[model samples]
Target: MPTPTKTGKRTSGLPAKTRLQWSGLSLAIALFLFPIILPISGLDGPQSRMLGIFLAAICLWVTEAIPLTATAVGVIFLEVVLISDAAIVPVGADATSAKVYFASLANPVLILFLGGFMIADGAAKYGLDKNLAALLLRPFGGSARLTLLGLMSITALLSAFMSNTATTAAMFAVVSPILKALPTRRARAGVALAIPVAANLGGIATPVGSPPNAIAIGALAEKQIYLTFAGWIALSLPIVLVLLLFSWGVLSTVALPVGTQLELEMKVDFDRSRAAIWFYLITALTIALWLTESLHGVASTIVGFFPVVAFLATQVMDGEDLKKISWPVLWLVAGGIALGVGVGATELDKWLLGSINWQSFSVLWLLLLLALVAVGMSNVISNSASANLLVPLTLGLGASISVDQGTVAVVIAIACSLAMCLPISTPPNAIAYATGTITNRAMLLMGLVVGILGIILLAFVMPFYWYGVGLLPVN
Candidate 1:
């Protein structure tokens, strides 16, 4: 037993995790005060204040000293109090209205995400996701190698329309029995690794696929650059497909190996009840509206609310079902939007742009550097937070570089999703790691290969491909 401390608490009373969280919170405060105590040479008062908030947000987000959503909402509150019109110590010229910061909580991008979350939640409630996986997996046959491909393909496809984390959970729930049935542990690890790798890569396929994607879209919208939902799919889907196939090949070869034979028993039991059927129709119509935005001239954000209204009004998804939606994810994205808004409103972006001589690096090198930095930061922090910090700054580079804001924002977003080396890198990665089938070494090796390949694709190949195909504006 541990000795009691002065405060009558045991010396070992707090868990290591709790102690670390408190330490992180302390560090965040110190970092936040740094800019205030020692102002930068060129930034104005408002800029310095924004810089402090930005640093503090990075520390809190990276450490998870508080709940991720708490840190997000905290950032918004600080921005309003410290730099908005409501600030106690007034700063001239750049201060924005408090409403602007608060409004981020319901930004159109978030509304779009909310709609996606509703559909995903409804799918899970009605057993639609699992049933779809079962129906889709039938064509790939029983061999472990082919099954790996089938599983990855389906995971990626589902992740495109759903949260990658949710997709991984749903997929894993479907396959956990098969994993236990596998004779060799190595085959289990291989099969297990495929789900997260596919889900992470697949998240880049559409704007609503992951939080980072929504972060990118939200940031770009503030700059008057809008990417239609289908447009994002067109830009990223090809790369997502190629990376999934590549990862599938690596996992099948390195983890599963040759001569590994396994059989799977997938049960398909989709709900055919009245409410489930109504949900299905609403979901299909919403997705169709999202995809045909160009033809219909309906904004994806407006179309996103269709399901929200339809599900609630018809009782297809009642209040209980609504309660199941991932509210934190939406808030996290909103915090990112508010961060971008504050940075832009304060002209901190201009100051930061001037602080760096971005022209010193060639276009190719700069793009590579941005993607590499995004991957590195996201490996240890929430990818959404990484995008939150990086996107606004990258968008500022539009004035300094010849590349369009869309390309830069999307590159960073996709690069963030490429981080999956550690269990902490993503919820999907954590879920896959929790199954105890794969070792840390196995995950790191696969994540590194896939991450490097993805970086190379984003930095070198995709830009030119986008330009050639007219997806990117030619410089």
Candidate 2:
């Protein structure tokens, strides 16, 4: 219906090729009709209907039939319009139960990320990320391997408390030029690929590091299983440190040919402007508050907004800066939260969870199974969607199994965070793919290996590390 572009290509077309379209549409239709035509899989009318909706949501999310946010919104609309009476309605009648879906728009996890987006946008706009990256990368001066490690370290350190996607983009901006200055493309690939992986790994270190972590916390909070900011750092920081080192080797050896090295250079113009100084001070204060949240009993979600207040009050970030906030990402997270809410309200999650035979598997085995499924699902769909779909069900399953639900919650979060195999897997992977330095084959192969390694580490190492952090009972 639209005119062709000046370049002679159609401006509007199907989002995917015909084959993909056929496959996706067929799958989506099949899922929609599945519950009606077949056995209910032992589910009742409401549970069967919920399963159909869940499958439809998964199909839409996976197929690119529409935008993910649209799919999420459609889920809420369908719930309210056609299936309201089936929802929990613990607080109100069928008509008002729709409020449950809308309530997630203001979910605490969404608020934290909303505030985080503003801070990250300000940091990027003011060149705070660059200034900081220059300082950190300069110390390794001249050794490509060390510089690569340094870049990953800084990226991980920042992502531990910030947005992984923002951190990956910022780090790529800072490091791409240095990599380009090298003799060949092979050398550039080393740090380019490693930065995103590190960003992903770093996000596991703190609750605020990644959305999945926040989702896990929010779901567990319903059951009174709490994990402090410090507690999360204790549980995940070691794994992050190991992954950073291991992934650096993989990029340097497997992704890039051995003997590839760059004389990396990081130069700083050293901006000491009032705004820059304020940026540094407020950022530091924010990190301190997030890290020490337990001591003050202030929720991190409450502390997250401090940056918005500090930056605006000091005029470090102006109205224009506010315009760049990741509003779409907030919407996306909100939609995912709302989907989780819908699952809870329908009791679909509880019914499925209760149906599982939990007595057969030990706690460690249960942890591994959940992690595997989370990682697998995240690879195919958006990680936030993966978390929303799985965490509530996982929490219910964990409690039913009589295991420490908090421990299972952490494992699931880590598994979701490590899904980096494809561009569709996570925002960081997509950002790295945009660099044009890595190939689909390279990313898929390397990401698969790294994802496996991370899962293995999580399975074997988490129990001991968790025990040390007091999140797990001594075996």
Candidate 3:
């Protein structure tokens, strides 16, 4: 009955807005509480509850209810104050040190990831990624579909050596100029979306392609499920090829124009600069080190560190540029590892797997179900955390089902990397969305379709191919 405003807007009380905000907050609180509250009280002890709380914190970060960095800090606080009665001690001590908070920080995998990022940052700053993209795209003869294929292949290849987010960002630097010079918005958007999809798809080609892959590899190694370089490649390459072709087909048929002309000048210096040569050399060494870990016993971290040192020593990138690296992402990965370790330490993974009913399903069906769950969870959580949480669970579940644990672990890891449903699902997708070329709705729709197809390939095709080719142990 109150009079309408000049703009014909209804007058709403402050109480109403406050109520709505409180309602949302309450819903979030409920979600955080439900897992712990609904479960049997004594079945999961304090450690298990703590793990659940850690996971809930990650979920809050992924959903943007809180900043991811802040969530990591929250994890440290929770671990110290609530989880254990153990006293804090100095760093460089044996077990039971205050450095426990930094336990995951010292992991070899983390060191390798940081070192790799340094190298990638150097490559990006030195125009190596741009040059590589230009070299690859230049030969496509200006056909949009062919150009799309070239972009996908190049991005995928780069992904094997670099972080998927970094690879996608590099690809964008090259492709954005081309898109801007195009005449139509539709063509620009199509190419823009294709770039990220390609980057994500390409990331499946190597163990170091994405965080999820690294997590899986590290987790399996801890379980003594060792896979050599050739072994992993034998399993991954076929899946990667099939998925890459599928992604290219989807973009060509669904989004991209058949006969679009590019008006931009493609000028790139393909000359091998000193820095580029050094980068290539470091990359080759890293790959060699990873492949020959058995003979040298040289940790991958040591191999990765050489590139970082070379980049700095050669003056390829300055200190300020290094500071701009994603520290929050590093923290998130650290916290995810801590939480994963905590889960195993507390035996929550075993308890959770024990509760699941795996009796009725075949091993293949169980693996497929796990893959679907990994894909869905990765969409809502950071893929690294998804991998951390699920890999151990998959291992335990596999034991319960009397199937090979390593096989289930690898499947979950791969599926975690396949998340493409939303920008928040993976950093590469977020990087692509930030370019302003693709709408959220378009990305979501296209990603959902692509993700479904990817899951299908992972579930039905990959296991057979891996086992048939002698890459994976047959049951």
Q: Could you say which candidate leads in TM-score?
A: 1
Runs off by more than 4 Å, candidate 3: 1-55, 80-101, 180-185, 228-231, 255-264, 270-280, 291-297, 313-318, 434-436
Residue pairs that clash (backbone atoms under 3 angstroms), model 2: none
Question: Each model's number of backbone clashes?
Answer: 0, 0, 1
lDDT of 3 at 65: 56
What candidate 2 gets wrong by more than 4 Å, as runs, is: 1-46, 82-96, 183-185, 253-262, 472-475
What lDDT is obtained when candidate 1 is compared to the true structure? 0.89
Write model 1 residue lDDT over 187-248, tens digit each, in one string: 88988999999999888998889899999999989988888999999999888989988988
For model 3, residues 21-69, the per-residue Cα lDDT tens digits are: 4454455567656765677654444544565555566455555556566
Worst 10 residues of 3 by lDDT: 89-98
- With a 3 Å backbone cut-off (N, CA, C), the pairs that clash in candidate 1 are none
Instruction: Kindly report which residue stretches of model 1 are placed more than 4 angstroms away from their true locations once superposed.
Output: 1-17, 257-260
Mind giving the per-residue lDDT tens digits that candidate 2 earns over 1-475? Answer: 9768789987765365467656876887789668846867566554565577778877877775767677767777666654465354222343336666666667776777766777777777777777788788877765667777788889998887678888988888777678667666666666678878888898889877787887888777656667777777878888888878888887766544545455656777666888888888898888788889889989887888788888899999888888887665666666666666666666777777776688888777777778889899899887877876777666666547666767777788889998888987888888988888878887888788888888887777777777875775534
The true-versus-predicted C-alpha distance at residue 73 of model 1, in Å, is 1.1
Predicted structure 3: lDDT? 0.70
